[model samples]
Target: MESTEWHLTSFVNLAVLTFLFLCSQGQVNGDCPADGRTWVPFGQSCYYFVHGNEDRFKSYTIEKAKEMCKDYGLLTVRSAEENSFIVENSLQVWKGGNNNMWLGMYYNSDDDEFKWNDESHVTFKNWEEGDAEDPEMPLIDTCVILHAASGKWENVSCSEQPQHGVVCETPQIRLQRKNASPLLSALVVISVIMILGISAAVWFLQQRKGSGSTLFPSFEYHPPFRAPSADQTCLVEAEEIDETS
Candidate 1:
């Protein structure tokens, strides 16, 4: 029973070490960047909502929003789920102004279709019913915006009035731990545990027996001269006398 407990403890230690290693690699912690923007993580992407609470945040045009976004593109709503996520983050908590916000999608007059600025294929959409569907059609400069009040999308000129605050989008980035290392350390730990287990077993067995007793008491060695049996004695004076007679 004690031996079983020792193995269980070893495995538990291994799992804890593995979890810590993964956390250090950002595989477990999910630590996002702190760029003074409110970033919400969903699926594999991260969305930034403009709440105007940060000193760096302000209202900007679509192009300017793209510029301020750094490596992140403008907000792109792909699915109703994603659209709802954006709405929950942006419109529900919007404090910027009455104007609408920009999306990564734009009307491409050449293809006569709306497409994402990031060039990801449009697999889903959450267009507001009725007039919101038409951006006056075939206009190359037409762009999409999130309607502030209704929490839906709207069509407008890329540089039109009612410009909005910047809501950037970027893949989540995690900080690398400078002191993190690999699994070789775990192997060393296992070696130490094994040595400890062997020592513990030896101690347990020694305690079960009395003091001055070896682990295998039957195999204890002693000098032949110290033996009490005549057969084991080194000197035999009676046998020597009989041989001379």
Candidate 2:
């Protein structure tokens, strides 16, 4: 019937709307960047793809670039994960000093090794040819980043300050109470309970005091809590004699 058809149509529409709402609430997996910006959840990084070299800002030194990111609770770029995130966003932002943007990894001259500031191994690498060839490079040092235009990796001097594209080291969240141990958690719980208990006690006392009426009341004190000695002794003695008789 026509009525049955209308009811089914309404049910289908309701189901579709509910499905859409739930889909939007959860994160999308393997999805491209949303809007003009790509959200790199893995690195907690957001990259904005800019076409050509038009609107790029003046390059900053590694330290200065780091400060800028830090101002926004972000850090200078570093690491392959971050590099991939930037490329995915397709932005030509400056890294390092003048031309190179700062990446997360840096070269350790003392150890003569390419090490991630995050302590992760550089198992994967994508370097450009004729790259990692800084004349002043240390024998045992190598930082990694994408080529300015090609988004390829190259080794550069860690000490050399550049005014180009640079990556930031994402700030790591340190569980300050990491070593707090179970005793610390217990102490915190006990302290909270004590505070709540004290507050409750104060509230109870205030309520009790408010409910009791002592205002405008008169007080008469009697020693030993007995009435005046008018004839108490005589009455007691007479009563005793009568009892004996």
lDDT of 2 by residue, 96-163 (tens): 22244556566666665556655555666666776655566564545454555566767664457654
Cα error of candidate 2 at position 141, Å: 6.9
Q: Cα lDDT of all candidates, in order?
A: 0.67, 0.51
Q: Give the C-alpha lDDT of model 2.
A: 0.51
Deviation (Å) of 148 in candidate 2: 3.4
**Candidate 1 segments whose C-alpha is farther than 4 A from its true place:** 1-29, 37-43, 50-59, 91-93, 96-99, 109-111, 130-135, 159-162, 178-245
Q: Give the TM-scores of the predictions, in the order they appear.
A: 0.58, 0.38
For residue 174, what is the lDDT in candidate 2?
28
User: For residues 12-95, could you state the per-residue lDDT of candidate 1 as single tens digits?
Assistant: 776686667546555433455686766889866787765554433357777777777767788877777877676666644564
Measured by TM-score, the strongest candidate is 1
Worst 10 residues of 1 by lDDT: 22-31
